[model samples]
Target: MARILIVDDAKFMRLTLSNILQKGEHHVVGEAENGTQAVEMFEAEQPDLVTMDITMPELNGLDAMKKILSNNPKAKIVMCSAMGQQKMVVEAIEAGAKDFIVKPFDESRVLEAINRVLG
Candidate 1:
C-alpha cells in the first residue's frame, strides 16, 4: 500500500481524507495542517503520495507544490481545491501535481484519482 501524507487546514477535511486513505489500505503516514508543515513533513517522511489543499495559511498549495517538486522531482502530489478555483487547478497541474480533487469530495472519485496516480 502507498504511504500518503494529508495536508489541509480543516480538521474535518484531514480526518475525512485520512479515513478514506486508511479504508483504501493506503498508509496514512502523516498529516499537516498547512503548506509549510506539509513541506517539512514531506522532506522528513518522503511519503509515496501527498494530498494538498490549495487555500491554506502560512503558504499556499501552489507554492508548496513547487517547493516539494523542487525537493523531489518525482513527488506524487494531488491538489485539493474548492469549486470555482479552476484556474488554480490548472496551475497546479502545470506545477507538477499528478491529479486534483475538487471540494465536497467524492470517495469514489478520490480513490480513483489516487489509484490512477499511484499506479
Candidate 2:
C-alpha cells in the first residue's frame, strides 16, 4: 500500500478521501488543509502520493505541486477538483500531476487513480 497525503480546504473532503484511501489499503501519512501546509507536509512526510485540491486558501494546488516537483520531480501528485474545473485539471497535468479525481469522489475512481499513479 502506498503512503498518501490528503490535501484539501474542506475537512469533510479530506476525511472522505482519507477513508477511501484507507479502504483501498493505502496508508495516509498526513493531511494538509491548504497548499502551504501541503508543501510543508510533503517535505516532512514524504508520502508516496499526494491528493491535492486545486483551489485552496494559501497557495493553490498548482503552485504547491510546482513547489514539490521542483524539490522532487518524481513526486506523485493527483489533483482533486470540482466539476467545471477542467481547465485547472489540465494545467495541473501539464504541470506534472499524475492524475486527478473530481470532487464528490467516486470510491472506485479514486482508488483507480491512486493505483495508477502509484504504479
Candidate 3:
C-alpha cells in the first residue's frame, strides 16, 4: 500500500479522501489544510504520493507541487480540482503532476489516479 499525503483546505474533502484511501488499503501518512502545511508534511512524511487541492488559502497547489518537485524530482503528486478548473489542471500536468482527480471525488477515479501515479 502506498503512503499518501492529502492536502485540502476543506475538512470534509480531506475526510472523504481519507475514507477512500483507507478503504483502498493505502496508508494516510498525513493531511495538510494548506499549501504551506502540505510542503512541510511532504518533507517530513515522504509519502509515496500526494493528492493536492488546486485552490487553497496559502501557496496554492501548483506552487506547492512545484516546491515539492524541486525538493524531490521523483515526487508523485496528483492535482485535485473542482469542476471547470481545466486551465489550472493543465498547468499542474505541465508542471509534472502525475495525474488528477476532480471533486467532488469519485471513489473509483480517485483510486485509479492514485494507483496510476504510484505505479
Which residue pairs come into collision in candidate 3?
none
Task: Assess candidate 1 and give its TM-score to the true structure.
Answer: 0.98
| Steric overlap count per candidate | 0, 0, 0
lDDT of 3 by residue, 69-93 (tens): 9999999999999999999999999
lDDT string, candidate 1, 1-119, tens digits = 99999999999999999888888899999999999999999999999999999999999999998999998999999999999999999999988999999888899899999999999
Tell me which residue pairs clash in candidate 1.
none
RMSD of 1: 0.5
TM-score of 2: 0.99
- Candidate 3 residue runs with Cα over 4 Å from true position: none
C-alpha-based local distance difference test score of model 3: 0.96
The deviation in Å at residue 44 for candidate 3 is: 0.5
